[model samples]
Target chain A: MPGDDGLRSRFPISFRFLDRSRTVAPPGWSRWLVPPAALSVHLAIGQAYAWSVFKPPLESALGLSGTASALPFQLGIVMLGLSAAFGGTLVERNGPRWAMFVSMTCFSSGFLLSALGVATRQYWLVVLGYGFVGGIGLGIGYISPVSTLIKWFPDRPGMATGIAIMGFGGGALIASPWSAAMLESFGAGAGGIATTFLVHGVIYALFMSMGVLLVRVPPDGWLPRGWTPARAAVRPLVTTADVSARNAIRTPQFWCLWVVLCCNVTAGIGILEKAAPMIRDFFAGTATPVAAGAAAGFVALLSLANMTGRIVWSSTSDLIGRKNVYRLYLGAGALLYLAIALAGDASKPLFIVAALGILSFYGGGFATVPAYLKDLFGTYQVGAIHGRLLTAWSTAGVLGPLIVNAVADAQEAAGRSGPALYTTSLYIMIALLVGGFTANELIRPVHPRFHEPAAGAPAAGRPLTTEGRQS
Target chain B: MTTEDPAATGPHPTGETTGETTGRTAGGGRAVLMAVGWTWVGVPFAYGVWELVRKVAQLFAG
Candidate 1:
């Protein structure tokens, strides 16, 4: 009878190996193992960046328009936001292993479905499979390792997250060339595209499985060697108190962060979405006109900047504090936009340097926000709160392209050429950065009302169950 | 499950279990895992960056 009570107390449900309870690190499990586990899922899902490599082939092979070819990518982005927001609480409840498993399933299956669609010449199926199903994988996979890494490496949340996020940014670097090679070898026809998709699905599934298997929740009271609560709370914004994701949405600080993320992303994405053509247009009339190949190079350079900034600037946040790092992102970002606007193509070096600076801040902004969320809100439901905050990214995804594309179109219609076409958009981006800077200034800590009482006291936010302690 | 296990304690309280005290698994396998984990993600990432740097060189060469 006592054994039965002990057994019931140890594991509420029959001890399944895959349970969140089972995933708890067995004392000596090296915390170093966690980041790579996080990176596995992130790197695999980050292939979302290479969606463009499929576009041209898909359009030609399927006899679709440019806009139609783009539907899958757009829907995927939208789903990334939606699934992250809605699935966040569940992710927090289920633990990283479960989330990673679900992500791998959805993501890999998305590729398989796309293969079927391509083989059958059903374009709509491609949209449904790659855009919707694969997108859920992207969303869930994106946040899976976030809070776990924070728990394991509270001393270096910024750096830990930056490492995994950098994987996402760099994913395209691998997928782009790899997919191109596959298309080249596979013939770029429907059959070839289908084979490529099939291969991609199988490969990514194998890759992401590493994360699902390797990820572990830290023990309830585990702290890094020499790290303590007082040490972590030395920062002005870093809170020792916890905030539930449900309560986080109600706070003004959350909205302020939302504005900051949306604005920073909008400014950066506007330039990124049109990086290749923008550089060419900027120098079209100059003595040194940028060639098409050079423009492609510029886009590649921006990708490098974007990828590196996630690690570099986000790691910098650890020493400088999240607020100060963001000050650099917004304030310096605004100044860079101003420099680009004023310098124009008068100096190619100035233009390239300024764009790179702006892009670094953009990638830094994405990589650092999770740490920022952990700072303002506590680690309790930080992943869930992070998931909800991604809605800002979705909003900016639409807003950024619209502002840049629309302004350029209007300028072209009005007989503008070269730098003239983008001048208004640049200025508009500068204004948005200024607004984001103001929002960054406005972010105060979440109020006590929003804070989830620590495990023992009357459950303030949610029930203080196993899920509550899992964080 | 009862909330009594030190493992089930609330989100990070002050120092309860430091990494030094928690018996570390000392073996070749743990070392191997650490190496393999980093290598698995590291190789592909390095390849990606190398490919990108080549393209980046083209931009500067122009």
Candidate 2:
């Protein structure tokens, strides 16, 4: 079933084993197994956040600037969006088994190749390895579990996705300290970096295998026990109609959600990119000012907020509709920014609450958006659609830092001190959130004309096979 | 909800095949297996939270 085309066609030998291994779940087999399967892959790839841990060492050992050292991580994120967007159709047709295998190979090899590069002192090899090769892994791996999890927990798509995505945020927490420890012991040289990269590659390949083995598509008519399509449809703005990935991109709703995601991510990332420095600056004029170490702690607390929000807020979305939850994310996020901006360094507790609240909503935005896609577009090709939507993240990643850093730098040039430095950026974030809120309000059900025809229409919870894939 | 894959095609990575078709209360060995699976995800999160809490405590400790 897996090795039908694309990479599967090229690697028929491996696909043969993987395809048979990833059987659709037999009836009455537990659906609960699916989340862990998804988490296994996400937790491993989520280590991308800890790429910064490699930065200081890489710059020192390789003799490069901060911008040059950041190139591979930046390129990795770029390729992540591109590969997922382009390869989504193949992923849908080939199924999660094939997708996971490709992710594992590319992601693991990226590290191994980086290991070789570090050993050889070739910066380009490191770029090609982690940036080009590993990025594709991030994209494929990120989306691989998404559709499967939604299928399993149709009753709670937001919560199902939250569980997996929370691992992505948590991944950095595990890796940042772990990689720091490794570099400390191994001496942060080219050999040490290579060792770290090699270990990451090997361990991730083994770890992600758990996802490949554990993930399953539902049988053609499977639904959770005591949950039916009718019960799920009672929520507003959700539809039973399916839109193929190709056709989905043609609709206005797709683009609107893209804008919504871009704005929300840009706002949150604007704050996150400058978390340590921003907190320190905000309290610099206060009596009990924040030290550099304390600022790092604030960043850690933001990470916690990010991960906690992914689970807590997204689960809350299951109770309230997807639209309403976004209303809170974008709407309340603006208010939080206002509080942070107007209050300045007047109070420590207010600054902490405002920042933490904003970070939580940022995490909530990522975890909530997929479920929203499921609601608007149906589960058909949702992974693919979600893949395309990740371009929003790439855009925000670049835009967020550019805006925050540029404004902060400009303020510093004018000899501005303290919270005034972030003032303009905070207001810009508020504008971004408000823009995102407006876009979310505009999202509506896809027009039925785009729906797949009756005879060949995919039943809810069934995998969408490409026409050529239907053996 | 469509095809009912039979038990003969048993045991992928999760060794629990459909052959031992226990009643559908979502219990027995499967529940234990579920606990193990959930814990696989939750344990790291617990550690991460513990680490963050320690960091957060520093803001007040000073």
Candidate 3:
């Protein structure tokens, strides 16, 4: 009878009791459940990485130039950052369910509209459907599950996020093959691309809904078993106060991180956007003729590295601490770019390793950033801050490709050959990474003025009122 | 499942129920809606795969 009571008490159907016991709850709602919810949104929105797949088709079908065809994808990324920044507070307020639902609706509709545009032979329709409308979905869906996972596994925030963020990277892995098959089956003209878009809208809408339905916030005050507030508070990395999303924008830390994210992303994407061309240039003089097939494999391998680094490197941050982890990312990333600039076609292995390393940092930057926010600001409103920080990504989305393409275009016009096209771009990325490294070093603890007073506890730190002015 | 267990006293877990598992009783509509919800999640992911493959092939072809 006594044992029964204990068993009943421990395993009470109502999660309310589990909160009180505060001991480790038997892996609350299968950890398995968390990944699917994250994957649903990430995998669906990940279509961004595969945007190049449509680039060729759109250019030919619309008789548009490369830059013109790229406009939609570029605009969609811009929208992603803007929407995520503006909608972040809304996402936090409404909960993941509402956020994901909206994402599904917008993203899917974007596709459906693109289909119509394709059927009608109107390029603007494709842009409106895929770029503007769907971009809203990409932004919203991207951050929808972040706060929830942090809430669920306060113990392992980095790994929890890595699982979902990795899905974003992997989405391309799945989509590249599948989209090709559909394009082949349907034909790669405007009609074929449009059909693919329609199918993507319908399908992603369906997939993302699972996350909306399954996600549940932990009851307030629920901490993992064996975890205590005192211990959680004591970590040198943890900040206890909540920063209003508005005020977060005013802080130097926010801008510094913005620069950090933008620079890191711009550096990586500059290479990624021009992966095949960069490789071709590197191997141009070799007898082997870097086959187009091998170049494609190189891209896929880069994706794998990107996805794997998100999980592996970010999870490692949990051990090394967020700031230190970023030091590695930026500091080493600059060196990698330098290696590429110096190596320039002479050594294939060095080139591959350097490129892969840079791409890994690119992905690591995304995955590690949320945890960094959690460390600097408390979990109080990290999702919103994160959403705000993503504006940098939108900026980088434009800047990264622009720098690479414009530079390459100019170099090609000058009849440059054999890695000269990218040398300047690589040096620019190195400067950007160095700047980011400096910003990382400048990040000290959140100023005392920013600390939120604990309930019924006297505030311990100096007020932050004057700190923002100093910056 | 009486509510006397001291452990149950913390802030109410969002979806906790103190009573017996109300065996297959309520919210059939909600359940169906959830099932439909999951379907929405799968379609995009499937499409993403299709798109990824097509692009990789083109990269190779060119």
Top-DockQ structure, candidate number:
1
Model 3 local distance difference test score: 0.75
The TM-scores of all predictions, comma-separated, are 0.92, 0.91, 0.83
Judged by lDDT relative to the true structure, which candidate is superior, 2 or 3? 2
For A124-178, candidate 2 gives per-residue lDDT tens digits of 9999999999999999989988887888788889999999999888888777777
Deviating ranges (above 4 Å) for candidate 1: A1-15, A457-471, B1-26
Winner by TM-score between candidate 3 and candidate 2: 2
Quote model 2's TM-score. Answer: 0.91
Interface RMSD for each predicted structure: 8.2, 7.1, 8.1
Best by lDDT: 1
> Judged by DockQ cut-offs, is candidate 3 incorrect, acceptable, medium or high?
incorrect
Candidate order, lDDT descending = 1, 2, 3
Tens-place lDDT digits, model 3, residues A1-471 = 001122334333643232222322222233335556777888878878778888888788878899888877877888898899999877776566667878989889998998998889888988998899989999998998887777666667888899789888877776767777788898888888888888888877777777765665555566655665566556675776655566667677878888889988998898888997789888889765677777876786677678778989889888878888889889999999999999888888789889899999999999988888877776666788899999888788779989999988999899998889889899999999999999888777677566655455655665443222100
Docking class for candidate 2: acceptable
Candidate 2 wrongly placed segments (more than 4 Å): A1-14, A456-471, B1-36
Ranked candidates (TM-score, high to low):
1, 2, 3
Residue-level lDDT of model 1, residues B1-62, one tens digit each, is 00112233334322336453343334345678788888989998998989888888878777
